[model samples]
Target: MNGLLRFSRGVDWVNAQVGKYIIWLILASTVVSGVNAVVRKLFNMSSNAFLEVQWYLFAAAFLVAAGYTLLHQEHVKIDVLSSRLSKRGQIWVDIIGFTFFLTPICLAILWYGIPFFLQGWRSGEMSNNAGGLVRWPVYAMIPLGFTLLMLQGWSELIKRIAFLQGRIEDPTAKRAEKSAEEELAESIRRLAEAEADAGKKAD
Candidate 1:
């Protein structure tokens, strides 16, 4: 169990790092989209490659961040029923869900996705659209993303089991950390207050 806990922490750290870095992909995609739009509208010139690259980046960011999303517990959930359960019950529900539902789904995706990616790579698949990018890189994200998600699922299972065994604190407890938006809002509030204080001193 101790070894498993250490492995879980490692998985969590990997996902956390991946999630943090993947945010830059979003910015890159946004920039590409803006540039593509401008080039299309202003110069009346565009290529499928530009459009497809943007899509690839978007897909990469979305898919690669799955494990990270899970680590943060930010995934959507239907809490209508489960919200009523005790913490232990909720953890049990998660264990069952991860074991029965999430793990199988990820495995199935990987089973199909690997072949899909390999076929594209082996055949040197290109987009049907004019001047489009190669297909394998985008295809590859499916299996890669699912693998990360599956690993995180195992990490979560370990954490939950450890918690149940009195080896750790609540596995589901949210960290009391503010989001970037929240921190920015706080900074703005402080600036406004400081400005108001200066005005008061002047008066």
Candidate 2:
């Protein structure tokens, strides 16, 4: 049990690091989109490569963040139903869902995704669009993302079981930590309030 807990923690750490780094991909994609739009509007010049690269980055960010989403319990849930259930009931629901639903889905994706990626790589697949990027790099994200997701599912399953066994606290408890976007929004709100207060004082 102790060893399983440690393994779960290690999987959590890997997903955490991957999630943190993947945020930069979103930023990069945004920057590329902005630049591409500007160039297209101002110069009336555009390339499929730029457009495709943006899609690739967006896909990479979305796919790679699956495990991170699972780790934070940010994945979609029917809280209206589940919230009405007892803690143990909810844990049981999660255990059943992860075991029966999530695991099989991820495994199926990996089974197909690996071959898809391999075919792209072997064929040196490129986009059909003019001046577009190669396809394998983006294709590879499918398997990689699912692998991470599957690992995190296992980690979550282990934690839920441990909780049920009285070896740990509630596995589904929400952490109070704010995300980066939340913190930034909070700072902006505080600055606005301060400015309003200063204006009132001047009046």
Candidate 3:
């Protein structure tokens, strides 16, 4: 169990790093979608292919970033009431909420999404719209996104258990700490620049 938890932590770390690459995809997809909308309105011509590509790109961006978002603890939280609790108290709440609510939903989504994508891929499914801009592989994102989300959920479960038992620190609460020496060095740089300017004015 201990080894498995460490392995999960490793996976989460890698997933978080990979998530950064999805930002470019998100930006490109958004630009394409916006351009498509403007072109359709101005020219009164439809480019169904552009529209389809936008959809696929959007899905790719979201699905790819899902694990990273969870790893960074950037997801929405309903911690209004829970924030006031003690460390042990929060652990209890997390365990209960995850076991009863989060785990089931993530598992179900992953289970259903796999078959959904497979069917679409097997049938070579295409857009039903007449003269649609593009025939997108719409089903690809569903399974991929949900699978990443499921893995993240499992990692969260493991981390929560470790935190409650005081075995390992809560992964989310850690911040990058800097040394006092680094701070002093930065202050010295600033002071030197200021003194140089003052001496130049006095000259």
Candidate 4:
């Protein structure tokens, strides 16, 4: 149990670090997109490589962030019914979902995704679009991302079980501070409310 807990902590740390660093990928993508647009308009020049790199960066960030999202418990959840359940009951629900659903789904994707990535890498597949980058890097993300996510799932499973065994604090307790997703959702909700108010004033 202690060993498992240590492993879980390691996974959590890795995902947290990954989540922090991947924000740069998004920023880089945005910069590349802005530069591409400006160059297109100003110099009447552009390349598919520039456009494709932006997509690569975005996809890398989105895919690699899966484990990070899970670590923070930021994945979408329909808590309406679960909220009414006992803490242990909620943990069991998660255990069942992680074992029966999340595990199998990730395994299936990895089974297929590994081969997909390998074929692309072996073939040195290039994008059909001229001046575009090779496809293997993006293909690799499918398997790599899911592997990270699966590791996090196992880490979460370990924590939940530890909590049930009285070996650790409740894994499902509300974090002290807001997660990035929660903050983003709140910001979006506030923006929507502000827009609605402006519309009402105009009317």
- Cα lDDT for residue 159, model 2? 100
* lDDT tens readout by residue for model 3, 18-126: 6745665666787888888888899987667787777778878777677767776667877888789887787777678767777788688878877877787787777
Model 2, residue 17: C-alpha shift (Å): 0.5
Q: Which pairs of residues clash in candidate 1, taking residues 3 or more apart in a chain or in different chains?
A: none
For every model in order, what is the number of clashing pairs? 0, 0, 4, 0
Q: Give the per-residue lDDT digits (tens) of candidate 1, residues 34-74.
A: 99999999999998998999989999989998998898899
CA RMSD of all predictions: 6.4, 6.3, 9.4, 9.0
Looking at model 2, residue 61 earns an lDDT score of 89
lDDT of 2 at 132: 91
Top model number, TM-score: 2
**How many pairs in model 3 have backbone atoms within 3 A of each other, for residues 3 or more apart or on separate chains, i.e. clashes?**
4
State model 3's lDDT: 0.72
Model 1 has an lDDT value of 0.91
**Model 2 C-alpha lDDT per residue in residues 1-203, reported as the tens digit of each score:** 99999999999999988987787787789899999999999999999999999989999989998999999999999999999999999999999999999999999999999999999999999999989999999999999999999999999999999999999998788889777456546766988999999999999
Q: Where does model 2 exceed 4 Å of error? A: 180-203
The TM-score, computed over Cα atoms with residue i paired to residue i, of candidate 3 is: 0.75
Which candidate, 2 or 4, would have the higher TM-score against the true structure?
2
